[model samples]
Structures are given as C-alpha cells and as structure tokens.
Target: MSRAAEAAIAASYKALKEDFVSNLTGGEIGEINYVTAVAPVALVLWSALQTRQSFFKPYTPLSFAVDFLLNVCAILLATTLYSSTPIVLNILLLAPVAIIYALPRPPLSKKPKVPPPKTKDADAENPLPKKPFLTIYRGAMLVVTCLAILAVDFRIFPRRFAKVENWGTSLMDVGVGSFVFSAGVVAARPILKEQLAGKSTALSTRLYKSIRHSLPLLVLGFIRLYSVKGLDYAEHVTEYGVHWNFFFTLGFLPPFLALFQTAFAYIPSYAGLAILLGSVYQVALEFTTLKAYILTAPRTNLFSQNREGIFSFFGYLAIFLAGQSTGMFVLPRKLSSTATTGTEQRKRLVLTLGAWSGFWIALFMLTTNYKYGLALSVSRRLANLPYVLWISAFNSTQILCFCLVETFFFPGVYKATTAKEEKEAYELATSRVLEAYNRNGLFVFLVANLGTGIVNMTVKTLDVGSRGAMGILGVYGGLITALAVGLDLYGISIKM
Candidate 1:
C-alpha cells in the first residue's frame, strides 16, 4: 500500500478503536439519538400523509422533502462524533438544520377542523380527576423512607450481598412487581370499599390506599438496591448483569405524575421552580468537588448515592414534572388567533432557543472529564448538579422540539379512531420517552431490559469476527427495534 493509504488506514483504525472503547465504556452516544430522532420523523411523515388533500395526488414530494431534511440533519449530528471541533459547533450547525426542517409550514390551505367522530367524542364534563397534594407528599415521603431503609441495609450488610444478584431480574422484580402490586390493589378498591362496613374496614381501606399509593415508593427502593447490585455483578457477569435499572426507576413514574399533578394544583409555579432549582443545583454541583465527593462515598451522606434523596430525586422529578406541566399548560388553551397566525414564527423561536441551549449544554458536558463508563455509579452519581443540569437542559430542549413538531408539524398524528385512541397514543409515546429517562419511568423499559438480556445470552455469546459481530449487532438491533415499534403500534402491553 502507498504511504498515504497506510496513514489513512491507520487513522480509520484509530477512530474505530476509540468508538469501540467508547461503546464498551458507555461513553459513546450509541444508537439512542438515532432511535429518538427517527421516531419523530416517522410521526411527522405519517401526519403529512394523513392530512394530504385529495387534489394533491400523492404527497410524495413533501414526504421526501421532510424525510430528506430530517435524515440529513440526523446524519450530520451523528457523524460529528468523529470530528475534532467542539460539540458546541456541531450542535450549532446541526440544531438549526433540524429546526428548519421540522418547522411546520401551513398546508396548501387550511383544512377545516374535522369534528371528531361521534363515537370518539370526549366527555367535556367528565374531565380528568383532580390530583391531591397530600397524595404527592405522602408518596414522596414513602420514597424517601424506603431509600433510608436501603441506605441502612447497605451500611449493615456486606457490599456484595447488599446488592441484588441480577440487575435485570431486580428491575423486573421492582418494575413489574410494583405495577402488579399497585394494579391489584387499585383494582380491588371497589370491593375493599364495599367491605368497609365498620371502622375496622375503614381502617383497612386507608391502609390499602396507602400501599396502593406508595407502590411507586417500593419500586424506587428495588431499583436503587438492584442497580447498585447489578454494577457489582457486572464485574463477574460482564455482559448480562440482567439489569433493568431504567424500568425500576420508571415503575414509580405514574404515581409520581399523579402526585405532581396534585401538588401543582396547590402551587401552580412549583413546576417552574422545580426546573429552575434543578438547573441551578446541577450547575453548582458540577463546578465543585461535589462530583468527586459523590463518587468516593455515595452512601456515607444523606445526599450520597441515594436515588430518592431530596436533591437527586427532585432534580429528575423536575424534568418529569416539567413535561407534565407543559402538557397541562397547552392542553386547555384554545389556540389564540395570534398563535395560529404566528405558528411558523413561534416555531422558529422555540427551535432557536432549543438549539442555542442545546449547543452550550452539549459543549459543557463533552469538555468536562466526566467518566462515561457503562456501569452506573451511585457513588460517582452523574445525577449531581452538573450532570443533572446538562441532562436536564438537553431533555428540556428535546421535549420542546418534540412539542413543536407535534404542534405545528404533526398536529394530527395522534388523532386515531377514538378519544381513547388519541389519549393512549399520547400516553404511550410519552411513556416510551420516559422509559429512556434515568429515573422514575417503567413499562417500556422492561422491554429494553429483556431485550438486552436476550441479546447478551444469545448473539453476544458468539465468538464472532469483527464483521460477524457487526452483522450480529445489526440483526439484533433491527429485530429489537422492530419488536418495539410493533408493540408500540399495537398499543403498549404493560406486562407484570
């Protein structure tokens, strides 16, 4: 080979090596960005097709335009991993491109709002039930208390025994376990209420309610307990720690949401304050020795590795709460004439802010020497202030982008056969995204965990060559994605 060709080959090998190391170490962005980015594109394309006018014939041109732009932007951002320039520059270049493509242009003409089908009519008077403040406060207390018990357990027991044997199993135990427990109790509420003929029955009802309400609390405890255990187990098991950390965290989400709704009723600005406080807390934590201290002795202090600690839990809660709050804020508002008039303009504004914020946050995270290992460290908790801030900012930006796409670009995507269909689709999408969150999200995550475990036990065990490994990964990933997409399309089945 020529000298130049040899140098080129060597450089390519070096990049591949870095990528491999990053993936093994959990440093690389991996397939997450692609999956998330693709979902919205698909939704938008569907919307375009569903809404096309009869006169327009095939809307292939517009579909192709949107798809081309979305793919191009996604490629640019994904490939920028190999670039030497700062992440800020990459974000700057990529965000605008994505936003521009995503901005909703008016349909050739305004189609009259199709009155929802008679069978699909929402009961205007029924309304969603009001969430109560006491419920949220009590749930929070339960989570805190459980975490406290786990902390005590950790201190008393040997580290190895204290942890769960299988992270995936632990997640299944906690995540699915909580859902089953909660659902069973909730389902029996009417029977339990009828049996309340006396004070004793009343007392039983109260106790049952508390357990039902705090199911999320129990799930959170299991997640923390087992996640830490999974990390330890990974030292031996390597590939299949059977860890479903995300599911464990998410199992608590529905109750958490219920609680937040109740709390928000009392303190309307609480959502905003949560976001502000979380952001500030994260930023402060990042710039100090706080990060190092967290890793060194996470269990020694109240704020240490405890996932349900006020600081860490609330920080993530802020994200979830913010998402819910935004939905609540938008759902009731009749789109004003001004909003409709400036749809394109407002979209540009949100996109601009999202892009700008995303740039700075991405830059900050990449530059920081934070370890990107696959094993989640309770001690080296990235849930600390800086990591929290970065993830929060990124999450918020993405949510905003998602909302804009839904609002302007894909308005009718969720309009299915009935009101229930619409409601379910929205819920499922939100749940899927939340499943990917670091804390307090459950259902879709069980799918991820089981998928990971199956992959590890099967294809991952093969002594494949590089090409073979790539092929295995491709097939495995394709199958998993297809299965997930199918389940999502068919309606998420929350398995216990």
Candidate 2:
C-alpha cells in the first residue's frame, strides 16, 4: 500500500478506537446545554416582541419576513456551534441572563386586585390553576433540546459539540445527559409528592411497576440495536445497549431507590445514601476487576451490557433519590409561593436554586479532587460523584435562569414592549403557542428521531460541510416543529 493510504487507514483506526474512550477523554464542555439553557428566555422574549393586533391576527408579509430572518438567525446560532474562542460562545449564550434583568417592566397597578375572601371550604381546597404557559414551555424545551442533542450526535454540528469541552461551550454530550435526566427528575414530581404526603410506597410494589413500565424499553433497545446494523449511517453499538439516556439508568432507578427509601425512611437525607453509594463504587474499583470484566464481555448478561448502562445506574439512582429529596423541599415552597409583585416568588425560587447549585458545585470539586478523582473527567457512563455534581450544579443554575426568564424577566419585557390595551390578545397568542408545544412533546421527539434517521439515509453527511449540514438540520427541525404545532392546534394528541 502507498504511504499516504497507510496514514489514512491509521487515522480511521484511531477514530474507531476513540469511539471506545471518548467518554473518558472527550474533554467535556460545561455549557453543553447552552441552546437549551437559553430557550426559555428566547421563547418568552420572542413572545414579548409580538403586537396584540399581530399576535391574534396572522402575520403580515413584512412581519413574516422579519420573524423568518430572526428565526433563521436563532437556528444558526444554536446549531453551528462555531466560535473563534470558547468565551465567545459563553458570552453569546449567557447574554440573556444579564439582559433579561435589565429590561424595563410596567409599573404596578395603583389599585391592587383583591382576591375573593377565602371561605373555609375554599381554603380547604386550594385548587392549582392549569399553567398552560409553563406546560408549553417544557414541551418546547424537550423537543428543541432533544433535537439539538441528536443533531450533534449525528455529526450535523461541530465535532467538539458531540463531546465535552470547556464549561461554557454549547451543547456538550455530558450536558445532554443532564438535560435528559432533568426530564426524569420532573417526571418524578408526582412520586415525590406522594412520598412527601406520607403515603406508603413499598419497594416491592414500586419495583413490580417499574419492571412492567420498562419492559417496552427493554424490547425496543434490543430491537434498535439489531436494526441499525445494515444501515450505512453512523451507529454507536453501545449506545442502544446500555448507553442511551432512556435505558438502564432510568430502568433501574425507580425500583432500586424505592427499595432504599423503603429500608431507610428512618434516615433524614439522601446525602448520606449518595455518599455511601459513591464510596462503595470507589472502593469496589480499588478492590475489583469489574472494568476488565466489562471490556472482555460486552453482552454477557442483562445486568452489565456496555459495562456502563448498568453500573451508571447506581449513580443515576442516587441522582433520582436526590431529586425526590429536592422535590420534598422545593415543591412545597413552589405551591405556597404566591406573588404579590412579579419578582417575589421568582426571586425566592432563584435564590433556592442558586443555593443548591452552589452546594453541588462545591461537592463536585471536593469529590472530583479526591486523590482518585482529578484523574477522570466528568463521565456520563460512570455517573459518579463528579459527574453527578457537575450536572446538578449546571441544571440547577440554568433552570433558575429559566425561571427568571419565565416569571419576571419576559413578562416585564412583554408589558414594557407592548401597549396595555393589547395585553389580553398577546396573552392569548402566547397561551395558544405554549399549549401547542406542550400538547405533543413526545410526538415531536419521535418525529425528530425519525427525521434524523431519514436524513442520514438520504444524504451523505460525511460529504456535507458545516453550513450545509446546518441547513439540513434547520429544515428538518422546522418541519417537525410545524407539524407538531399544527396537529396539536387541531386537538390531535398522540398520547402514550
């Protein structure tokens, strides 16, 4: 073979080898979720820019042109992930955090609207109002976040984004895990509430239910693994087996933690359990040859496929337990927090999240530096203390920023930017948009996955340049988003 061909072959082999160790050495990005992090603020800010007349009415030619241009800008900004320096991405993504607080808000009403007197029965039954806006926002975030993460994974974006980079880099792969985990955390809201209400949540019963719930995923994961073999596109063999976000981590978490909660209700906090579990893993690594076992036997049993999907469950379950513990503290305050002024409730929530973020940051540093620690970068596979702390810190901080945008910042911007008489119509449009997005988040997620697969099949992604790849992603994402919104508006909800 020619010398040039040998070098090329060597490069391909190195790339293949990297597929195995990418999680270890990919150099994780801290702001991996920058696109997701900025979305809530962007959505609200965009809504604020709408006029009452145009909000309720269909957009005119000029308005449509302007919105289209701005949306294209947004899409490129989100997907290209190109920056001369990491700090540029940081400043661009973090701009909203600073800018939101600076926007002028409407003055408080001279006559504060009085609530009807709480009768004894009314006080007894304080019904939670249906928060359409928040619901829509979550759905949108899920769809958009899922799309962006998948795009990077498919090599539709910059290569650096598919792995970890500096803290402020947009859409790190590790950060993607946190985004997925956050949804799981949110989904546990009801379970957390049940535990807090002093309900008897037996581990056995929870385990049985979790098994039933996870059975479909068990079937699907195997099927997906098998089906992708003949396809000419990229496929991560381990990803479906144990590495996918929705697989082993989620499968074992509920029942495993329920067992712990059942046995240890006497304990005051999840912190103790987290430390104990982490220590056990750390010690086991010192004493055992499990790493060798995993590398040698890829699919030996149901428990440890890809070595990580199973082992990471311990760390993920810890995260879930911590989430429930957090719910115990956070949900009650959220329920009782009534805002007299726009910022009051939001201020309280942000402060709480900020405190938790700081705590997690400190824990991450301490744990990561544990002599055995600084050697490893943050890992989604292991889901260890450093990984857990890094995700928690970022998720808390970003979610707080999102809350600020939704609660005080965007609302203020809306009022200040629009006339008082147009308020009702503007609200109506925002509500409708939110409801549309909220109604079919799962549908859109599936749609995006399907679209991604189809696009890969239809086009030579390796032959495509960054700009072309981004354009493809844009059209694909736009189509899915539009279809989802349209179907939802027509009251077509494809529920699981």
Best candidate (score: lDDT): 2
Cα error, residue 175 of model 1, in Å, equals: 18
lDDT (tens digit, per residue) of candidate 2 on 237-325: 44334334454345556556656766556766765665567667655643454433333333646655556566666667666655554
lDDT of 1 by residue, 1-496 (tens): 3566445545654564355433232222323333234434433433343333221233245533443233222222222221223244334434544544466654665669986556634323312211111112122212212222222121221132122321111111121222222232123233323423332334445455645755764675575457557644222221111232433344444454444434544666533644565556655555544433332322433333342333334444554454343333233212233443234434544564466457535643553435752222211123333333334344444445455555553333223334565454343223221121212213333444444444444543334444554344335333433444345446565433
What is the lDDT, from 0 to 100, of the residue 490 in candidate 1?
60
Q: Which stretches of candidate 2 lie over 4 Å from their true place?
A: 1-37, 40-44, 47-76, 81-141, 153-156, 164-172, 192-198, 202-204, 230-233, 238-245, 270-275, 292-305, 333-346, 369-376, 410-439, 491-495
Where is model 1 poorest over a 10-residue stretch in terms of lDDT?
166-175
